[model samples]
Target: MFIAGDGAGIGGAKAAALAGKIAALDIACDLDRLTAGDRNAAARPLRRRLVKERAARPFIDSAYPPYAAALAPQDATIVCRCEEVTAGDIRHMAGLGCLGPNQTKAFGRAGMGPCQGRYCGLTVTHLLSEANGLSPDQTGHYRIRPPIKPVTLAEIAAMAAPEAIEKSKRSNVSTQVNG
Candidate 1:
């Protein structure tokens, strides 16, 4: 799996686009869709542009560092607003031997809320790492399941249509008969 763009630590839209192109070229080469020489030829310009795009990142980051307060919120500060999980709650979980965000879910439904872990995952990890005296990498992230997108009641109801219900019944009957 190739992680380009911000995931690869190349920030900004231009840099991300360039990194994506480079990653695509590399993947194509790996799949033999493009020869190594051809891939290199195609990626040279993209790499140069990506370097230029990333040049300003240091300056931008220095100008606007991450919010320090977020890294170390007050005990009562709600880290996971969706589930109303507080920093103190996360620390408490750590004290109880919760080593990571995924484990914290079993202790308290922090990242299991509607937004999943999008907004709070980082904070949760940071808090857990601090409390457990481990690096964020060691603290780990959420075990992302399906339905990544928010499903409305109407969408769910649509899935329960007569045809789908019939399919479900047939599948269940098939499973039972096979068993």
Candidate 2:
């Protein structure tokens, strides 16, 4: 659901909380029964009373400041390693009539990469917001395209054979000519 990113930008806190809950709970729940249609089915068989477990105390270690990456660096440092798009590059797009992340992406390939903007989307949004004098929400992040099916290494290797590729190409050419 949070493909573009959560509002806080970092989802580590939620992951950390889930980890804490899993560690604390001693319930012997079967893994397979956990599904949308039958959530808590395994737990239901146990029928153990589940009182509201108080959330663990918030972890506080002032030793390091909480997430400072997004706080600063209004500099021209390269943000999108995939596209080599810098903060200045994003701002320049803004100055050149690019209002939001999508526009910048279309204009300069800022978020178009193998990583699919996972690494640089947050930074691009920040830069766009600052440049356009709008909030991050206003200069929204890129919309997620539908996910393609994942392929295994073995599947890729099988497709790499030259004879297979040539056969496929010949079929494609024949179909095109007939059509």
lDDT of model 2 at residue 23? 28
lDDT of 2 by residue, 1-179 (tens): 22222332333555444433432232222344345335344334332322122122232334544355663355668878888887778888988989887787788998887777877887788778888899989988887555587889998898778788899999999999998
Could you estimate the TM-score for every candidate? Answer: 0.68, 0.49
lDDT of each: 0.89, 0.64
Question: Could you tell me which 10 consecutive residues in candidate 2 have the lowest summed lDDT?
Answer: 48-57
lDDT of 2: 0.64
Model 1 lDDT tens row, 92-135: 99999999999878999999887778789989999999998999
lDDT of 1: 0.89
